[model samples]
Target: MADSTVKNTYVKQQITDAMLNLLRTNELKAISISHLVAAAEVSRISFYRNYTEKEDVLREYINTLILGWHVEYENSDKKSEEEMLGSLFAHFSKHGDFYLLLSQRNLFHLLKEVLKTLYGPKPEYPNFGAYVAAYFSYGLFGWIEEWFARGMQESAEDITILLKNRK
Candidate 1:
């Protein structure tokens, strides 16, 4: 039983590495199952066994990345609001290419899901906490897109300062 779980983990890691490599050199739209299979050095059957489609692979990758951030935020008692924002910005900056590609309107829904998981369930329509979470997630995504498009000229410190000063 444990052996199968370990093997599955290994195969998933291979697929993730292949996807990251392909993403680095090509647009997301350009990546196909054949390319991913070839890069992973795995058969089509292997790829299919793990993922239903390329979109599934991408969804898994993004969710895993965001979940890790959520876990860090949840576990840490010392992270101030500024530190949390800085950490989020730093993460997006490190994976700017991935975020830029995943910054479409549809992807914001995924961000919203992550927000719900991180912040817990929203209240009624006028709930301030819910509103803030939605605004922060959506706005932060837009901010990341603009930063990447501009070649990320600002340092992380500068960006962190900007976030800190926001009302």
Candidate 2:
């Protein structure tokens, strides 16, 4: 089990670097497993040993980020929602390039799940939490994608402030 864990870590690290480097030039759809293995200098068996698909690589990376957000939230002062979001954006912007690459993947489901976890059970809405989760997840991701497309023209705080000011 320890050996498998170590191997997985090594394979994942290699694949993550290869994918990110490839992302600088190639779209995710364009990057085949063969290309990834070659760039990562890992065997096909090794790749499959750690991940079933290329998208799994991205999923694991995002899981780390979302977990980090949860940790930050727990450590943070219980302030207004805007402040927490602004802080989260600041962290997101800190790793802007990786996130820009990440944004291309269809992470809507992931975001929706996380938002649902964050917001929990809100009985105030007539449609239950599904509608609210979808609205927040899609809207928030769309907003960030636009911000990223603009080359993150404004600071994270500015972006969050814009959202906060929205009527």
- CA lDDT scores, all candidates in order: 0.73, 0.77
lDDT of 2 by residue, 1-167 (tens): 99988877888899989988987788778999999999999999898878899878776777777778768877888578788778778877878767766656534344445555555445665685668666776677677767776778899889888989996
Runs in model 2 deviating more than 4 A are: 103-126
Residue 82's lDDT in candidate 1: 83
lDDT of 1 at 68: 87
Q: What TM-score, over all chains together, does every model reach?
A: 0.75, 0.81
Clashing pairs in 2: none
User: Candidate 1: how large is its RMSD?
Assistant: 3.6
